[model samples]
Target: MNGDKAPVRVWCDGCYDMVHFGHANSLRQAKAMGDYLVVGVHNDEEITKHKGPPVFTEEERYKMVRGIKWVDEVIEGAPYVTTLETLDKYDCQFCVHGDDITTTADGVDTYHIVKSAGRYKECQRTQGVSTTDLVGRMLLLTRGHQQRGDSEYKVERSRTESMSEDSAAKSPWTGVSQFLPTTQKIIQFSEGKEPKPGDKIVYVAGAFDLFHVGHLDFLEKARAQGDYLIVGLHTDPVVNQYKGANYPIMNLHERVLSVLACRYVSEVVIGAPYSVSKDMMDHFKVDLVVHGATPVATDVDGEDGDPYEEPKRRNKFMLLDSGNTMTTELLVQRIISNRLSFVERNQKKEAKEANLWKAMNADQEK
Candidate 1:
């Protein structure tokens, strides 16, 4: 009893997308407020209900949150309904939320339950940046950019040049490309050709370039919370539009292979113009949508006389922060900063190897 009482448990929720430093700071502060932190990740459907549309899918969001270092446990559910029932289920003595939610109309804030339980607290908002701010900045930086097209053209030309000599060579795997899936046969061997039903699918999407361990962990966690995990892969054009010109290092096909290889992922669907289509979700019978802790919720319809609200279905969304880890942008920056050193080291090694080969050939001739 004394041991249980010693560790204070806290509850926090958000649609953690992009999983940036601001989100990490928030989770760090939230964890400092209590001994144990249980995070809630909002599903895609719930996000659509509240905020317009999220950039990354629920799985991507979950992965981003789970990657955070401060998060102790992740709960896949809606963010808006931080109810007493949930608090009781988790045995949470304290509820934590950002100071920003203090004036919301839905008086049903996290502090309300914590105060009712006699242990409510508000964590400080991470200063400087947010997912929204980041997205806005990216939009500002990459708007009307033609660099992506140039990069794509360059990479394609290089690939063609490399393959020019092998044009007559037979393809390795029948007619299929190296990046394609193993087999088109969707039937399972053990189940004996049973038609797979589109069950209660949970959809999540993102670019997912430079796949990392955090990405894997999030997918595993999100898949456990649902029946099927449908990952939405952003096409090059879509990524260029949303993420800007200097984004998506790996092409769409490569990104798909990286995600498809994950055990938690079931199917990878390409994203449309923007946001996951409600029709696609309905067609797939998507029961829930999952996202990270810091996802940018755009397409707010409140000011335009549209029925859709800014943050849709606030109650049904779950915002999770599992742990903070590596990001693609950070990785790229590191590589760029060390480019000269890497090149010099590689050049030295190649010269040494060539000299040794020449010496060996001379000895063989003698």
Candidate 2:
């Protein structure tokens, strides 16, 4: 409560497994609607019983949710169902969620309790992206989805055409529509802050797809080394050329938002060059260039040249072991190992959402 009126505290809860720009967008909207945003994350056991095995663990999900820039607070181990008691406890004026539906294993709406009490609000879901969609891409090893070229138009075109006639079969939960990104969306997610003078600016570059706890840990350590941390996200094609096998589950713009959402990131170089050059270093005034424990890859031309040669020659390069061994490859493998479960989860989710839409349409027609 600031200056006579009680501050609006909004409540948002979910499994938040493999938290992406979609989740961040929802939380961003939630924060915009209120003074404070309190996010509740359900535990792994609850999520497994209700949906299926999550790509990330409970602790990972908790940390990821907390990393979202808009989140004011995080409540770990939240119940699968949203209840008035929970809202009362958090002093949240109302609960907010994406327009999509969330249900338990028995196919009951998790938010029915809050909806009936008129304490639930819905924001439009970010289309064309979801954990299910990412898992599907990983399992299928689809490489045609990477947005090529620099312009936003090309990016949107690539993503839209990436979806085929059978996209429904690919990921029922997320559908085929590509996530339309605009300059405004990027501006919205940006911190809009400049590095103070004498601030040691640290620059790190990577694919950073499906941003997980490992990336978070590395960024945290990098930020600890300097006052400002800038993450250089390589273009989709560069990543695919190096990673191969349908790398970068999320496209460039998607990766931009994901990295910008992190509290540790002060700025992001969208579609940054694969090689860290001297011009780039001088331009950003980067004081230190950091890389995770994972060894840097050679140039994309199949040459023996190192990508970090400039940083190393300048003595600006520093290798930091975040102590977390998690990698994007490991994450993809997790989904692959549980391929059947994820497929079933997507099917059931799509069915439930389809039914809900049908029921809503019927009531409206009446």
Candidate 3:
């Protein structure tokens, strides 16, 4: 009978906004524990009512989770309150969540009901990386270089460790498999995975913030044009100069993983320049440069500026059809449309994460 049993179905659910290595690692661990790993993404309304304004919408979160190498099926609109009925509906034997405490406004644990029902399981959270830490980095970037006081326990070391953690298949998340560079990813982007004989190298650059279908489609099209696709991601400062208002909801490393996760993307330039220069082209041996149909941004002089200026002058520039593509602008507007609620949600989250971080520090001091 034991040999005849069907594969066990494991279910893990979360908001998964600002999907990162930590989330990926958790999913990987959950996946390793069972045969089939299905992730449930709570709806935006449920998340907003509970966790606060998510950097990414439920829809965006759904896509991001699906893209993770460890994830199998993704259930949209999973109930915020996980019930035995919810588990039964999905044919899941049990639910998995991180060890971190995620409670409600009234200090009610969301998983309490499920845990009491004996349908809950906990997974060890990976140390050194979290969405809260990343968000803090973004907020503090504007503070200019400042050092933490001797009395204040520093989060700097953890931040560096988190930053340096690879998001590819080699990440701590997946059990046996990690993202290994193909020749193209090494050559073009590093790039990795060396190109085959006579293979052309395609170059494209952008903020690629809040990476969406538009970015995916654009990258896919670019990949089709050449054997190797190298995507240059601009710095956050460069992105801000062009795309004001806390642009690039996700950071450089986050954006890098988002792009590198895409099958169409062969490699990535972590901090690529805003403008395409001759040296960059020669360095990467770029045969072509592609841009989406989105409008270009201007420089400090307020003059119309295209980053791909040199590519055009070299007659290697081309425009890809993004097909009514979604932009970071539209994505931002969606969150902004619910601005008051979103802002309040973020503030609450900041306060909560801050308190938790402080408590952790205090415990360590003790």
User: Using lDDT as the measure, which candidate wins?
Assistant: 2
After superposition on all CA atoms, how large is the RMSD of candidate 1?
20.6
lDDT of 3: 0.68
Candidate 3 C-alpha error for residue 34, in Å: 5.6
Put down candidate 2 lDDT per residue, 235-308, tens digits, no spaces: 88888888877788788988999999998999999989878888999999999999998866786846778888
**Candidate 3 on 1-366: residue-level lDDT in tens?**
136787777889888886765676678778767778889898878877777667776776887788665677999998776778878887888888888767666656678888998888888775544554444435333211122333322344333233322312122221111123234422322225766778799998899876665676677778899999898998777777877766666656556766775656677888898778899999988999988887677573355676677899999999888574577677556654765564345445545645665566799999
Query: Looking at model 3, which ten-residue stretch has the lowest summed lDDT?
Result: 169-178
lDDT of each: 0.54, 0.85, 0.68
For each candidate, give its TM-score against the true structure: 0.42, 0.91, 0.63
How displaced is residue 205 in candidate 3, in Å? 1.0
Candidate 1 or 2, higher lDDT? 2
Q: What would the TM-score be for candidate 1 when compared with the true structure?
A: 0.42
Residue 177 of candidate 2: its Cα lDDT? 52
Better of 1 and 3 by lDDT: 3
> lDDT at 242 for candidate 2?
83
Number of the top TM-score candidate? 2
